[model samples]
Target: MSQLANIKQNIDTIIGADELMERIRAGKKLRIKLGVDPTRPDLTFGHLVVFNKMKQFQDMGHDCILLIGDYTATIGDPSGRSDTRPVLTEDEVRANAETYLEQAFKILDEDRTIVRYNSEWFNEMSFGDTLNLARKMTVARMLERDDFAKRHASNSPISIVEFLYPLVQGYDSVMLESDVELGGTDQLFNMLVGRQLQKDAGQPEQAVITMPLLVGLDGVKKMSKSYDNYISFNHTAKDMFGRIMSISDETMWDYYRLLLLMDEERIEHHKSDHPMVAKKHLASSLVAMFYSLADAKHELEQFEQVFAKNQRPDDMPEFQWDSLSGGETTCPLLNLMAGTDLFPSKKECRRLVEQGAVKVNDESVSDPKAILDKPADELVIQGGKRKFFKVLG
Candidate 1:
C-alpha cells in the first residue's frame, strides 16, 4: 500500500490535518507523540491501535515519542468519565509505570522510540510555575468538554484536579514540539487541546489522529481493563489465542481490521469460511506477533486437542495425592478444589461445579454436593479450557 493510504488505515478521525498528506509526501521525518496513563500495570490490545500507527510512522523513518503519564494519572484523566476518578499517590503512580514499557516495547521499536515520563518535568515545577501553567485554560472553557458538560448537566461530582488534566496533557505536546499526536477517538477533545496549547506556546500546532475504540471480547463495550473485557499483552500464547477466539462472531471483522490489518478483500474471504476457522486464523496471527509462529501453531494444536477432540492435555499439572487431600479419604469436590487453591474458596468452587464449568477425569460434574473419592493413581481436574491439574498418589 502507498504510505499515504497506509497512514489513513484503522483511523477514526484526524483533526486539523488537511495538509498532513502533502507533508508526508514531502517526507521530513515527523515527531509523533502518544501518551498513556499508567493507572494500571498492564497494557491492553485497545492500546495497540495507536501503537500500530506509531509503528507505521517509525517504519517511515519518523520519531515516536512515548510519554508515560506518571504525573497525569495522579490527577486522573476525566475524559469519558462521569464521576471523579480516585487520585493515586506518587508512589502508586511510580509503581504502576514500571511494567508499561515492557509491554509497550512488544509493539514499539525500542531503537526508534523516545521514552519520557511526564513526571520528569512535572516534578520540577514550582508552585508559581504550576499556577502559570494552570492559567492557560479557564474553568469556563474547561467545562466545554463534552464529558464535563454531561456531568455538570446531571449534577455529578466533578473534582478540581480533573479540570487540570487536559492542560497538563496539552503541555506535554508543547514540551515535545510534536508534529502529530495520537489517541483513541474518545480522546479527540484532549488531543485537540494539545494542538491549541502548542499554538499558544509559539510552536507549530500538532495534528491529532484518533483511532476507533477496539470492541472487547463481549463485542459490545470498548476493550478496557476496568471492564474486564481486555486481552492483556502479558497473556501466555495459549491464553491469548483462546481469548481472541472468544470474541463474538460479529466482532471478528472489527478485530480483523484493527488488529490484523487485513484488507477488505482478504477479510471477506475470511468471512466466507466457518466462524471458528476464521477465529482460529485471527488467534494464530495475533499469537505469532506477540510470541512466535512456532508457539502460535502449538497453541492452536493444544486448543484443538482439549476442546475439539475432547481429549485431555498432554502436559497436565501434577499433585501428590495424600499430601493434597490434607488427610481425608473422601472429600467434597469443593474441598479438593479449595485445597489446591484452584478456587479462592469452597463457595466459588461450588459455583463453578454447579455452573457445569468443572470437569473430573474427562467428565463434566455438575453436582456441587458430589463427594470425590481419593485418587488411586491419577485424577484429572479441569476448571475451564485454560486450567488442568492432575492428582497423583
Candidate 2:
C-alpha cells in the first residue's frame, strides 16, 4: 500500500486529504489542532483514540496544538446533543481543564504540545465583532446540523449560545492558522465548520481527520462519563486493570485496535488461535499503557489471586474506625454507602442492594432493610460484579 493509503486506513475520515498530503510531502510541519471541552473530570480510554492519532502526527514532527476550550465550554458545545447542556461556570471549567491536561500528558508529550485557551480570542471579541462573525453562517445552515434539527422538531429548548459554539470552535482554527484538525467521528460537523471558516477567512482550509469512537464496557453507547460506563484514567492501576477485564468480550477487538495499538494481522491471528489469551493480552497492554509494566503485572497477579484463587491482595485499602461501645446506633445502609462514595446516590445504592447486586464480604446482601449495628470489624460492600469497598470499626 502507498503511504497515504496506510494513513487513510487508520483514519476514519479525512476532509481534503489530497491537498493536505501535498503540504506534508513538501516537508511542511503542519500546525494540527485538537479541541477538547472539559465537561467531565475524568479522561477515559475513549479519549485515547484521538490522543493516539495526535501522537502519530507529533511523531511525524508536526506541531500539535491543543485547544483547551475553556471559553467554549462555558457555553457548552451542542454538536451531538439533543438538549442544551448545563453551562459550566468559568471556575468549574478551569478546574476540569487542569485535570484534563494532567491526564492528557500521560498520552501526549508536554514538550511538543502547544497548549492554548480559546478565551484568548473569544474573550476579546466585542458584541459587534461577535455579531459580524455570527453573520458569516446562515440560520438555515446552522439548523442543518442533526442535533439542532432534532431539537427544533421536538420543540426542545435550543439556546442561542449553543448555536454560537461551533462558530467559536471554528474560529480557533482560524486564530491558530491550523493546517490540520483531529477529532472523534462525533466532531465531524464541528470540524467541517472550521474548514468552512478558514476558507472564508482566505486562509488555507485545514484538513479534518476524525477517528472512530470507543465503545464503553457496556458494549453499547460511546464511552462517556454521563453514562457512567467509563473506566477513568484517574483510577489506580488495579482499578483500571479490573475495569479492562470487565469489558464485554464483543468489544475486545475494538479495544485492541483502538486502545492497544496491536497490528491488524497479529490481532487476527490471536482472535483465530486463542481468543481468551488475546483478551488477557489486550487487558495487560492497556493497563501497561496507563501504568508502568511493573504495576500492570502486579495488578494482573492480584486479579488472578483474588478471583481465581479466592485470596485477597496484600495491599487493599484498609478502612479503620474506632469501636462503637454499648448502644445500637443505626443508619440507613444507603446513606452510609453514599457517604463513603461507594455509590453516587441513595437511589442507586438502594436499587443495587435490592436487586441482590450488593454483597457483604463474600455473601450477597439483598435486604434494603438490613440495619447494621455499629463496630463491625470487617464489613465489605460490593456493587455489581466488580466494585467492592470495606468498612472497618
TM-score of each: 0.93, 0.92
Q: TM-score of predicted model 2?
A: 0.92
Candidate 1: residue pairs that collide: none
**Local distance difference test, per candidate?**
0.86, 0.82
In model 1, which range of ten residues has the least summed lDDT? 16-25
Q: Kindly report which residue pairs in candidate 2 clash with one another.
A: none
Tell me, by lDDT, which candidate is best. 1
List model 1 lDDT by residue over 128-217, tens digit each. 998998888888898899999999999999887888888889999988989899999889878888988888889878889999999998
Q: What are the RMSDs of all candidates, in order? A: 2.2, 2.5
- Per-residue accuracy of model 2 over 170-240 as CA lDDT, tens digit each: 88999999999999887888889899999999999999999998998799999988888888889888778
